[model samples]
Structures are given as structure tokens and as C-alpha cells.
Target chain A: MIRAIRSELLKVRTTSLWWLILIGVVAFTAVAIAFNMLATYVTIHPGTVGPQQGGPDSLLTSVTGLYTSGQYAGTLLAMVFGILIFTNEFFHQTATATFLATPKRTLVIGAKLIVAVIVGVVIALITTVLAVGSGLIFLSTQHADLYLGNAEVLKSIGLNWLAFAIWAVFGLGIGALLRSQILSVILGLVAMLIGQTVVQVVLALLSSYFHVKWLMKIAYYLPSSASSIMTSPHGADGFEWWAGALILLAYGAVAAVIGTVITRQRDIS
Target chain B: MADGQIVVTGLTKQFRKVRAVDNLSFTVQPGRVTGFLGPNGAGKTTTLRMLLGLVTATSGTATIGGRRYVDLPDPLRIVGAGLEASSFHKGRTGRDHLRVLCAAAGLPANRADHALEMVGLTPAAKRKVKGYSLGMKQRLGIAAGMLGDPQVLIFDEPANGLDPEGIRWMRTLLSSFADQGRTVLVSSHLLSEVQLFADDVVIIAAGKLIRQGPVEELTNLDGAARQIRVVTPEPDKLFGALELPRTAVAKDENGGFLVTGVTGPQIGKAALAAGVELHELAPQRADLEKVFLELTSGKAGIR
Candidate 1:
């Protein structure tokens, strides 16, 4: 297992895509921090409705949200990172050599999953540093409340990191489910970017028209929706962060199992 | 079979309608080079894939050293299988590519450089594979195969894209591996090249074994069927003397008789008894290329 992980990491490092994605992460994280900071400042007007007491979308919640501004992009990128790591084996045709070295196919996929986690960890760490650094600079300049060392604020930051890690695993699962490089990537991006929103809106509309309130609640379980529970400081649909994490992880686990079983039973030729 | 020998028993791979490999059974012994010959789509690649555990066989079992390839705890160390020359990450350098294999196999990192040197690719070891020509990639694949210095080596078309010079190098490399008492199984369409280096040949056509024997025996080098160019003052007498089962006498350019089914000694004695004076007697053998063509002709069945 250790050797597999090391080998998997080496495979990623040799490719130029890893660093290219890192650059995208850097720029996107910076932009996310700047924009989220501006929104926090605008949403909480100075000398009027300044920093609400402590509920969903309150001043404290908004301020903590600024600290994890990169969560949206971080999660998405981590997911793509996961997708590529697994799909690249087939894309670049390295799976043969990989299996030849370690004939246990599942072990190699397991190693790839571990590599995906590392990618998420790195992305989470980078975004956290950038968002926190920028937020600290903004708060100090205005002499506003920093909300530093607050438990909720700390939890939000940790969850931001956790969200990225989990999303990466989720991405890996999607890649395994759809092994084709172009197909899985396109499907993943579409599902994460538009499919969730479209489905949620349609479900809400149908719920209202049919007077079925339960239909709208189903949106809360969507992978993208559940992920927001971890990164978004505001309590969404009254679901806890841990519940969101579990729901999101469930989707990934199912897909990964299906992918592994199919690969194990199918002929590579 | 015995230790370190590859055994494929009643192996059959059916791909929907077409039987890619049909009840194939053959044993590849250790310490000798066994050439796996077949026409296109003759299941050579599929058999190799199944043996390495890349492709799941529809039926039968392929085992090395008395265990399945996947069952081996350290398979790479026990058997180094060479992939297709084109199966490489184009973005990575040859050295990096080998290092990844080493990392996966738990081999030393420096072994990558050693392998590159062994294949004479050290100069371009740092270059990305995207820039490599087909022959260079072929060498790199061989280098990867030699990484473990395993007791068994399996290569599919190891000389597929190599030039004559490169083919000679590969022949030498394979010879040395077998010389070290390692089992080597190579599948190639180059029958003449295989005849030069391979000790034994496993010929398959239409997904079935056509022949399996030593190169010399398959070519009839020791049999009466071996072609012998005969030059005599009386061609009719010599031709009549060589009339035997499985023997044929054909008129040569200078009225000499090319005889089969009768040894040179038998022809000599018969010629002397028949008062046929021989001007020239020489062995003109039919090489493996001829035998392969004859055996595989019309057997591939458009597959």
C-alpha cells in the first residue's frame, strides 16, 4: 500500500497537468478570497445592520464565510483532480504497466484514491492560507471584528479543508464510474456545475405546483448541496456538517465500488 | 511442468462470437527462449494479457511458477512483462517512467538509470517519451522488462518497430537473459528473426496451436525431408535413387536435383550404386520463414 501510494504520487508529479492545475487553484483561490471579502463587506453594511447577533447568514457567519472563500473552487478543482488521477491511467495507457508491477488491480486504484486525498489536502491547505491571510488583512485595515479563535469560525475553516478532501474522493468515484477521460470530465463538470442546480430548481417548482413539500427537501441531499453544508457557515436546510460529509462520501463510495468491481471482473484487452 | 515454467492449460477466450483463443495449451520451459508466433488476431496478445492478469480469461488458467500471476506476492520481481512500446505516458522522461515502475515494484530508484543504461538509452533517458521514435520506445519497453532482472521475461513483439541493427541488439539482450537461466517468451511476426535467436517456437494460427517444437526440428533440419541440392552428371538416375516417402526431386537451374525425404548419405549411396556421378552435393535447407508461411497459410480465416 505504501509503495503503491508513492508510485501513484510519482506518476502525478511527472505529468505537467499537476502543476497546471495548481496554477489554476492559485488564481481561483485568490479571486474567490477577494470577491467573497467584498461580498461580506457589502452584505454587512457599516453603521447599519452591522454583523447580526449569530444566526444563519448573520454578521459572524458572513465573516467566517470569508475565511473559506475558496471552498467552492477548491472542492470543484479537487474533484477534477480526483477524476484525472484515475482516468489518466486509462487515458495515458499506463494501467498495463501499473497492473504488471502490482497485479492486484484494486491496490493500484486504492493508491490512486490516496493520491486524490493528498491533492485535496494540498488544495485545502493552500486555499485556507490565502483566504485567511486576505481576510486578516481586510479586518485589520478596517479595525472591524476579526472573529479570531471563535469555535464556529474555527470549525468552518476546518470544514472547508474537509470539504475539499471529500469532494476529491467524490471526484475519484465519478471518474471510476465513468472511466472515459473526456466523458467523465464533461459529465462531472456538467453535473456539479449545472445538473444540481437545474434539478434542484425543477424539483422546487414541481413541489410548489403539486403541493409536495418533500420534493424540495430532496435537493438537500445532492452532492453539491451537501458540500455547501460543510463550507457554507450558514446552516443550510438544518443539516449538520457531519451529515453532509457522510452523504457526500456515500455517493463516492458507491461509485468507487462499482468501478472497482467492473474493472476487476472485466478484461482489460 | 516444473518450477518457474509457464503452463497454459486448455485456455479458451471467446469474445462474443469470435473465439480469440481456442482451447490452447502449451508449456514454456525455463532457461530457454520460446518464440510465440501467430498471425494478426491469432490471440497472441490476448494470451499474453491473460497470463499477466491484465485481461480476464474466459476459461482455463495461465500460471507461472505454479501460481497465477495475480497470486504472486511480488510479481514484478518474479516476472517482468514488457508492455506495448506505445503504452507509455508521453509527458514523462524515460528515467521518470522507469522510476514510477520501480516505485510501484518496491525496487531501488537507481535501478531506473541502470535499466536505461542496459538498453543503451542512457543518453536520452532524461528526454520525454513524446520525442522518442518508435524504435527508441521499443528499447525503453525492453528496459522496463529488465528492471527486476526476473527469472521469467515475457515480451509481445519486442522487435516490432526496431530496425535491423536494433533487432540485433534485442536478439543479443534476449540471448543473455536466457543464458542466465531465465525463461523468455517472446511473441513476434518476425519468423526469420525468431529462428535466429529462439531455441523453441510455439506456432499458432486461427487461435489454435499449429506447431510447437525446437527451431531445428520444426524446420526439418535433422530429417530426410530436409532439402538437399544435388548436382549429378545423370539427373534422372539421381532423381530415381531419391524416390522415397515424403521425398520430392525438382529440376534445378543447372539440371541438378533438389531432393527431400532422403538424407544426403542415402542419396550418395544410391547414386554410387546407380552409377550416377555427382558433380556437386550441398544442403539447401528451407528456413523458418518458409515453414511458417506453409503452416499459417489460409489458417487465419480473415481473422
Candidate 2:
């Protein structure tokens, strides 16, 4: 198992995918920060205060505004990275060598999961730090009393960054289940963008006819819905942040097991 | 571990309705190059994959060094395999590819460089596999196979895209591995190539073992009739003189006599006794290619 992990790390380090993902994350985060900064500058210049009033709100006006956009971009970035991690093997025929070297399919899947989680956390942390730091600079220019060290602001930032890790695992699960980059990415996008809308519409229509509000509550525990809950300031009702994390972890576990089983049974040709 | 003995017993693999490998049983002994020969779609690759645990067999067992590949403590150190084309990531450098495999096999880091040099790819080791030619990629595959210096090596068409020189190098390398008391199993459709390197030949056809024996034993005529071609001034006299029951004489394309079912020495003695000047008396023994075709043909009941 250790050897498999070491080999997986070596592959991740040498491939160009890692660099491409890093550049992508940094670029998207920077653009998100710039857009938020521009919006804050326009709203706060000429000594005009925004509607929101508070140390956290005034200090993080730019960052708070960029959160929605940054989170979306981060999810997409993680999905691409995750898809490439598995699909690249199929595309390049590297999986044959990989399996032949290890032969224990579960070990390989475990190693991939470890690498994906680590990469996900690192990218998430970097993007959040850059966005927050840039937002603070813009706030300073406006002479707003924003406190970066405030408990609420720190909690939001830390939780939001941690959300990246969960989303990364979720993306890994999707990639494993689908096994193709294009298919996995399309499925991930539809699940992220339209799954919630469809579920909400169904929930609204069925709430009057049936007393099964638990169905919608369960939907909130899905990786996509739960991830939003983790990042949002006000957590969803009946679903705490820790519960959402557990749901995402469960999804990852199920995916890893299924992927390992299929891989072990199938031919590597 | 079985200590370099590959014992495959009743190994069977099926793909839906198709039986890719059926009840395949063979033992690849140590200290020899065991040639796995078959026609296209004859399940050679499938068998090799099952042996390496890359593909799970539907039933039976294929164990290397007396243990299933997945069960081996240090599999790569016990068995090394090079299957299919360029299994490395196209974007990764050859050096990094070998390094990753070395790490997986628990071999020392320096083995990667030594393997590259062994396959004569040390100079191109740093280049990405995407830029490598087919032959170079094959060389890198060979390098990867040798990384752990395993006791048993399995190669599937390792000389597929190689030039004559490369093929010679591969033949020598494989033979040397066997000479060092390692078991080498190579699968190829090219009978001529295997003729040069293989010490024992296991021929399969239609997912069944057709024949298995030493190359020379399969080709040599132990008791079978041998063809003796002869050119003589008088064809009729030569034909009448050679009145053997199995002997048949026909007119050659050059207006000479083509004699069959008689040895060269028998023909020469007959010609001398009949006062006929023998222009040519050439004995034709069956070659491996002929024997392989005959054995693999559908009429044979091996399948």
C-alpha cells in the first residue's frame, strides 16, 4: 500500500496535469478577486457606504461578494483535476502499466484517493487565501474597518476552504463512477447546476400533496447541496456542517469501493 | 513463491459468450525461454494477463513463483512483465516512468537508471514518451520490465516494432535472462522470431493448447518421410530406379526430377547405381513455420 501511494505521488508530481490545475486555480481565483475588488471600489468610492454594516461585512465586502463566484470556479477546477486523475490513465494506456506494477486494484484506488484529497485541500486553501488577501487590500483602500482576525470571518474562510476538500472528494467519486473525463465532467456539471434546481422544484410541488419534506432534507445532504451548506454562513435547516461533511465522506467511500471492485474484475488491456 | 516456476492450471477466461482462454494449463520452467505462440485472437494476451493478475480468470489458476500475482509480497521483484504497447504516460519522461514503476515495485531508485542503460535508452531517458518512436517506446517497455531484475519475465511481442538490430538485441537479452536461470515467457505470432530464441514452444489455437515441445523436436522429422529433390539427366531412369513405396517423382520446373519420400543419401546411392549423374539431391526437412501452420489449422482437434 505504501509503495502504491509512493508511485501514485510520483505520477502526480511528474505529470503536467498538476501544473495546469494549479495555474487554472490561481487564474480563476485572481479573476474572481479582481472582479470583486472592482465592484467594491465602485460601490465605496466618493465616501458612500454600502448597505451592510459590521466589522466582518465591511472588511470582507469584496471577498463576500466573490465567494459565490470563487466557489463555483473552485468546484469546476476540482472536477477537472479529479476527472483527469483517473481518465488520463485510460486515455494514455498508463493504467495497464499501473495495474501490472501493483496488480492489487484496491491499493491503487486508495492511493489515488489520498492524492486527490491532498491536492484538493491544497488548491482550496491557496485560492481562499488569495481571494481573502486581495479583498482585504481593496477594503483597506476604501478605509473600511474590516477585521480579518474576527472569529466569524475566520470561521467562514476556514469552512469555505474546507469545502474544497469535500468537493474534491465528491469530484473523485464522480470520476470513478463514470470512468471517462467528458462523461464525468458533463455529469458533474449537470448534477451541480441542475440537480438542485430540479430537486427544489419537485420538493415545492410535492410539499402540499405529500408530507415527505424529508426527501428534500435528504437532498441537502448530497455532495453538491451539502457543499453549499458547508460554505454558506447560515447552514441549512436539519443539516449541520459536520453532517454535510459526513455525507460527502460517505459518497467518497462508496465511489472508492465501487471503482476498486470494477477495476479488479475487468481486464487491463 | 514457486521460485521462478510459472504453473498455470486449468485457467479459463470468458467474455460473455466468447471464451478467450479455455482450460489453459501449462508450466513454464525456470532457466529457459518459453515461447507462447498463437495466431491472432488466439488468447495469448488474455492468458498472459491472467497470469499477471491484470485480468481475473473466470476459473482455475495461474501462479508465478507458486503464488498468485496479487498475493506475492514483492511481485515485481519476483515476476516482471511487459504487455501491450507503450504502457507509460505519453507526457511523462521515460526516466520518471521507470521511477514510478520502481517505487511501485519497491526497488531502489538507482535501478531505474540502470534499467534504461540496459535497454540502451539512457540518452533518451529524459524525453517524454510522446516524442519516442515505436521502437524507442518498446525499448523503454523492456527497460521497465527489467527494473526489478525479476526471476521470471513475460513479454508480449516485445520485438513488434523493432528493427533487425533491435530484434537481435532483444533476442540476446531474453536468452541471456534465461541463461541466468530466470524464466522468460514471450508471446508472439511471429514463428520465425520465436524460432531463434525460444527453447520450448507452447502453441495455442482457438483458445486451446495445440502443441508444446522443444522447437527442434517439433520441426525435425523423427520417423516421418523426408522430401529429396534431385536433378538428373534422365528423369525416367531416376524415377524407375527409386521404386520405394512412399517415394513419388515428378518433373521439376527446370526439366529435372523432383523426388519425395526418399532421403538425400538414398537418392545419391540410387543415382550412382543406376549410372545417372545426379545434378542435385537436396533433403527438405519440415521447418517450424510448416509445423506451426499444420498444428494451428482448424482441422487439428486441439480446440
Candidate 3:
């Protein structure tokens, strides 16, 4: 097991894919920071825009929302990292050599899962720190409260990191299930970005017209909805923090099992 | 490292509708190079993959030191395999690529450099695999196979992209590896090259073992079928006069009589008895290439 982990880390360290990891860190954090700065500026200079939209309290939520919201951006990047960790082996035909070196296929999968979790947490932390730090700076410039020691704010940030970490594991499962790197990455991005949007849009239309209050109850268990509630607990009809975490955990667990079983049973040829 | 023999018994692999390997069995002993010879799509790669535990065999077993590859504790320290020259990430340097395997095999970090040096790839060790030429990639594959200095080694078409010099270098390397009492099984579709270095040959055709034995023994079996080519001024007279039992005389392309089922000296003695002048008498030796073609073309059955 130790040898497999060492080998997995070595493979990642030596590849040029590290550039992508760096790009993920900078891109996600920069985008979140820019949005927070723009929002904070608009809140301070209300007359500069057409009209003042929300009150200062709502503005404060949006300001800190950057820190928690950046989790999805980091999750996208971490998921890609996780997918590449396994897909690269298949793409390059290194799986043959890997299995030859360590014939226990499950051990290889396990070690890769460990690497994914580690990378996920690291990327999550880096993006979270940058987003929150930049958010604090922008809000302070407008003399708004930093909320540095607020338990709710701190918990949100911590859960945001945890969300990204779990998403990385989910990415590993997806990569294993779909061995094609391009196909898996595209499907992952679509499911994370467009798939969730489509679901939310359909659910809203259904509830608004049909007045099916019970249908919205099931949305809390969806992975994206669960993750959203985990990072921000103030949403309507959202599951509790523990329930949301369990929902995401369930997704990761199911994906990991399916991925591992398929990988083990399929011939490497 | 003590027991390095490889035994493959009734190994078979079927891919959905097609059978890639069909009850193929062979043994490779230590201290000698065995050439796994077959035409393209003849199941050589599939068999090697099963032996290395890359692909699961549908039936039978392949073992080294009386243990399956996966069953062996620390397989790389016992059996090293290069199933394909292209089995590597294109974005990593050769040295780093080897380091990954070394780390998996629990070998020292310096072994990567040593392996690179062994294959004469030290100069390009730091270059990414993408920029490597086909020959360089082949060399790198060999280096990776030898990384652990294992007792048993397997290579599939190791000489596929090598130049004449590179081929010679590989021949020497494989010979030396065998000389150290380590089992080596190198597969190739080229018969001439394998004949140059291999002590034993295992020939397969259409996913079935056709023939296997020492190189000399296989050639000697064909030696008895050797044809004698005789050049003479009078073709008609020589053809009728040299009447041999079960011997057929056919007109050659250049107007020489190709006498089969007879030796050179018998032809000479018969010529003297017939009082025919002989300009030239030469024995046509049967090489592995000819026998390989005959075997694969279904002209020769398994022996």
C-alpha cells in the first residue's frame, strides 16, 4: 500500500499536469476575489449604479458569500485533478506497467483515492484562503465588518473546504467509471455546471406552476443541492448540515465503489 | 533470483468473440534466451500480458519460480516485463518515468539512472517521452524492464523500432542478461533477428503453439529437406541421368536442376556414375524465416 501511494504521488509529481493544478488555484481564487471586490464597491457607492438593490445586510451576505461560493470553483478544479490521476494512466497505457509492478489493482485505486483526497483538501484550502482573504480586504475598505471570529462564517469556510475534498473523491469515481479522460472530464463538468442548473430550473418551474410543495423536499438530497446547503445553511428547504454532508458522502461512496469494482473486473488490455 | 524458470501451461485468452490465445503452452529455462516468435496478431502480446498479470487469462496459468506473477511477493523483484514500448506517459522524462516504477518496486532511487545507463539512454534520460524517437522509446522500455534487475524478464517486440546498431546492442544485452542465469523471454515477429541470439524458439500461429525447441534442432529437422541445386551445360541429360528415389528434379529459373531428397555428395556421385559434367553443386540451407512462413501459412502443422 505504501509503495502504491509513493508510486501514485511520483507519477503526479513528474507530469506537467502540475501546471493545471496551479492554474486552478489562481483562476478560482481570482474570479471569486474579483466578484467580491465589484460587489463590495457597488454596495459602498450606491448612487453610482442605476439604483440601490439590496440593503447593507444583504450586501454583507454577498460579500462573505464569495468565500463559501468559491468552493464550487475549487471543486471543479479538484475534480479535474482527480479525474486526471486515473485517466492519465489509461491514456498513456501506463496501467499495464502499473499493474505489472503492483498486481493488486485495488491497491492502485486505493492509493489514487488517497492522493485525490489530499490534493482536494490542499486545493480547497488554498482557494478558500485566497477568496476569504480578498473578501475581507474588500469589505474592510468599505468599513464593513470582517466577521473574522464568527462561528457561522468560520463553519461555512471549513465546510466549503470539506465539500471540495469530497468532490475530488467523486471525481476519482467518475474517472474510474469512464476511462476516457476527455469524455469523463466533459461529463463531470456538465453534470456539475449545466446539469445542476437544468435541474434547479425545472424544479422551480414545477413548484411555481404546479404548487407541488412536496417535490421541493426531494431536491435537498441531490449532490449539488446538498453541497450548496453544506456551505451555506440559510437556503430554503435545505437539509441540515449533517444531512447535506451525508448526501455528498453518499455520492462519493457510491461512485468510489462502482469505479473500483469496474476497474478490478475489467481487463487492462 | 535463484529459480528463474518460466512455465506457461495451457494458457488461453478469449476476447468476447475472438480467441486471442488458445491453449498455448511453453517453458523458458534460465541461463538462455528464448524467443517467443509469432506473426502479427498471433497472441504473443496477449500471452505476455497474462504472464505479467496485466490481463487475466481465461484459463491455465503462467508462473515464474512456480508462482503466478501476482502471487509472487514483490513481483518486480522477480519478474520484469515490457509488454509494449509505448507503455509510458508522454509528458514525463524517461528518468522520472522509471522512478515511478522503481518506487513501486521498492528499488533505490539511483536504479532509474542505472537502468537508463544500461540501455544507453543516459544522455536523453531527462527528455520527456513525447520527444523520443521510436528507437529511444524502445530502449527506455528495456531500461524499465531491467529496473529491478529481476531474475525473470519479458519483452514484447523489443527490437521493433531499433536501427541495426541498436538491434545489435539489444541482442548483446539480452544475451548477457541470459548469461547471468536470468530467464528472458523476448517476443518478435522477425525470425532472422531471433535466430541470431535465441537459444530456444517458441513459435505460435493463429493463437496456437506450432513448434518449440532448440534453434539447432528446429533447423536440423528442416535440414533433411534441404534441396541440392546443380548447374550443368546439358539440362535434359542431367535431369534424366540423375534418377534418384523420391527425388524430383525441376528446372530452375536460371536453367539449373533443383534436386530434392538428395545430398550434394549423392548428386556428385550420381553425376560421376552417369558420366555427366557438373559445373556447380550447392546445398540450399533452410532458415528460420522460411520455416516460420511455412508454419504460419498453414503449410506446416504443429510439430
Candidate 4:
């Protein structure tokens, strides 16, 4: 098992995917931190910018948002990393060599799951650092407290890391189930970016038109929504931090089980 | 030689509507190179994949050392197999590719370099596989197969893109592997090449076994019909002497007669009686390519 884990980690390290993903982390988090800093800057000192968008009321909330600015992007990239872990084996036709080296398919997939979580955590860390670094400098320029030592600010960043980790595992499950690199990445991105948001919009519209408040509640159960609840400073309205974490983890658990079972019985050819 | 023997019993694999392998059974002895010969889509690759446990068998068993591949403890150490020629990452260097396998199998990292050196790929070890030519890729595949230095070796179409020297090198390598009391089974369409090194052959056509035996036994199978070459000064006289058998005599390009179903001494006596002086008269042993063609009933895909 240790050998498998080492091999999986090596597999990721040997590919160019890690650095490419880092570039994405920079692109996404840089934009997000820049946007969050501008909003916070305007909120703290009104009349300095264009019409107010009404940013977070408190400095802690503003800094927390700044720290977790790119949680969604981090999680999305983590999922992509997770999907690639499994898909690359088939896409590159290396499944034969991989399975041949370790005949126990479940062990290989399990090792990959561990690597996926590690990768997710790593991506989250980088994004957090980027956001925090950019946010701190921007805050200093605007004559606001850095707030890096605040516990609430720290907790939000911690959850941001946790969100990346969980989403990565969730991505692995999807990759294992799909097995095709292109399809898994595409579908995973679609579900994260458009599918869940589309469902939430439809549910919200239906609830408002029918005056049924219960209809909008279904949207909170979605993976992205659960992720939102866990990564925020104050948990989302629908679920607590732990509940959100559990719900997101449950999706990963189901995917891992189904994926492992399919992979175990699958013929490598 | 004793423990490395492979016994495939009634192995059958059906892929939906297509029956890829049909009750195919063959055993490979450790001390001999066994050639698994077949035509295109003749289930050669499918059978090798089944033996390696890469593909599930619908029925029957393929066991090495009395255990299925999946059940084998430390399979890579026991069985070094290269079932796919191009099962590698394009971005990874050849050394890294073998090292990955070495890591997975718990072998030393140096073994990757050793395997690459064995296949004459030491210089290109640092190059990514995408930069490799077809023959280079084939060598990489063989290098990967030898990574474990196992007791059993299996390769499918291993000589697909090798040059003549490369083919010769592989032939010698496989032959030597078997000679070292290791079981070696190679599936290929190169009949003449297999004829050179294979001790035994398991021939299949359309997913069914057509023949299986020692190379000598399969080639010398009913050797009577293959004529003895007769280059004589009096070709008409010798041809007429063997005319009693009707189809016994065939005209040759050398202005001679090829006599069948008759001993060399009998042909000499017939020539003596006809007063035909012969310059050359030698028995021609049937080549494997011809025998293979006949056994598969001309459906042989011997490349």
C-alpha cells in the first residue's frame, strides 16, 4: 500500500499537470483576490471608487472572504486533478502497465484517492497563500488592519483548504466512475460550473413563483452548495459547517465505492 | 523450468457477439520458447491478455506455476509480461516509465536503467516516449517486460516494428530467456522468425487452435509429399522413371525433376535403371512457413 501510494505520488510529480494546475490557481485566485480587495477597499473608504457594491460589513468578514476568494476555483481545479489521476491511465493507454504492476486494482485506486486529497490540499494552500499575500498587500495599501492573526479569518482559510481536499476526493470518484479523461473532466467542470447553478436558478424561480419556500431548499443539498457552506466564514443558511463537510464527503464516499467496484472488475484491455 | 511452466486449459473469452478465444488450450514448458502464432484478429492478443489477467476469461483457466496471475504473490517477480506494445505515458521519459513499474513492484530504481541497458536503450533513457520511433517503442516495451527479470516472460507481437537486427536481438533474448530455465511465450505473426527460435508452437486461426507441437514435429508432419530435388543431366529420363506415381514428379526451375513419395535410394535405382546421371539429389525438409500455411489451411497470416 505504501509502495502504491509512493507510485501514485510519483505519477503526479512526473506529469506536467501539476505546474499547469498551479498556473490555473494563480489565474483564478489572482483575479478573485484582486476583485475582493477592490470591493473591501471601496467598502472601508466610500467615495474612493465608483458606486458601492456593499461589500462585507466588517473587516474580519472582508478579510475572510479575501482569504477564501478562490475556494471554488481551487476546489474545481482539485477535482480536475482528481479526475486526471484515473483518466490519464486509460487516455495514455498506460492502464495495462499500471494494472500489471499492481494487480490489486482496488489498492491502486485507493492509493490514487490518497494522492487526490493530498493534491487538493496542496492546491488549496497555494490559492490561499496567493489570496492572502495579495489581500494583505492591498489591505496595507488601503490603511486597513492585515487581520491575519484573527481566529475567524484563520478558520475560513482552514475550511478553504478542507474544501479543496474534499472536492479532490469527489473528483477522483467521478474520474473512477467515468474512466475517460476528456469526458470526466468535461462533465465534472459542467456539473460544477453550470449544472448545479442552473438547477439552483430553476429551483429559486419555481419557489418564488409558487410561493413554496421548500422548493429552494433542494439546491442547498447539491455538492457545490455543500462546498459553499463548508468554505465560508459563517456556514451557509441551509447547513452547518460539519453537515456541509459530511454531505460533500458522502458524495465522494459513494463515488469511491462505485468506482472501486467497477475498476476491480474491469478488464484493462 | 519446473515452476515456471504455464498451463492454459480450455480458456475461452467471448466479447459480446464475437467469440475472441474459443476453448483454446496450450501449455508452455519452462525450458523452451513457445511461439503463439495466429492471423489478424485470431485471438492471439486476447489470449495473451487473458493469461496476464488483463482480460477476464469467460471460462477456463490460464495458470503459471499452478496459480492464476491475479492470485500470484509478487506477480511481477514471477511473470514479466508485455501484452501491449504502446502502454506508456507519452510525456514520461523511458527511464521514468520503467522506474514507475519498478516502484510499483518494489524493485530497486536501478533496475529500470538495467532493463533499458539490456534492450540497448541506455542512450535514449532520458528521452520521453513520444520522441521514440516505433522500433524504439518496441524496445522500451521489451525493456519494461525485462524489468523484473522474472521466471516467466510473455510478449505479444513484440517484433512489430523492429529492424532485422532488432528482431534478431529479440529472438536471441527470448531464446536465452527460455534457456535460463524460464518460461517464455511470445505471440507473433512472424512464422519464419518463430521457426528459427521456437522449440514449440501453438498455432491458432479464427480463435481456434489449429496445431501445437515442437517445431520439428509440426514441420516434419507427413514429410512424404514434399519432393526430393533431382537435378540430373537427363531430366526427361528421370521424370519418366518416376512417372508411374502420376503426381510424384514435378518440374523444377533448375531443369530437374522433384520426386515425391519415394526414398532417395529408390529414386537413385530408378535413375540407374533409366541410365540417368544425376548431378544433385537431396531431400528437402518442409519449412515452417509452408507447414504453418498448410496446417492453417492457407489462412495463415505469417508476415
* DockQ top scorer: 3
Q: Is 1 or 2 the stronger prediction by DockQ?
A: 2
Interface RMSD of each: 0.9, 1.1, 0.9, 0.9
Over A1-269, each residue of candidate 2 has an lDDT whose tens digit, in order, gives 88888998899899898888888888888887777776666555534555644444553544555543476678668766766777778778888888878877778888888777777888877887787677666677778656566555666677776777666766777777778878888888787789868877787678756877665676786677777776656567966666776776787678766876777677788
Better of 1 and 4 by DockQ: 4
DockQ per model, Cα: 0.71, 0.75, 0.84, 0.76
Clashing pairs in 1: none
> What residue runs in model 3 are displaced by over 4 Å at the alpha carbon?
A43-60, A207-210, A234-236, B244-257, B299-303
lDDT of 3 by residue, A55-121 (tens): 8566656666766646767788888898989899899999988988889899999999999998888
Model 3 error, position B297 (Å): 2.2
Better DockQ candidate (2, 3): 3
Report the Cα lDDT for residue B49, model 1. Answer: 95
- The CAPRI quality class of candidate 3 comes to high
- Evaluated against the true structure, the overall lDDT of model 3 is 0.84
User: Model 1 residue B7 lDDT?
Assistant: 93
lDDT of 1 at B272: 84
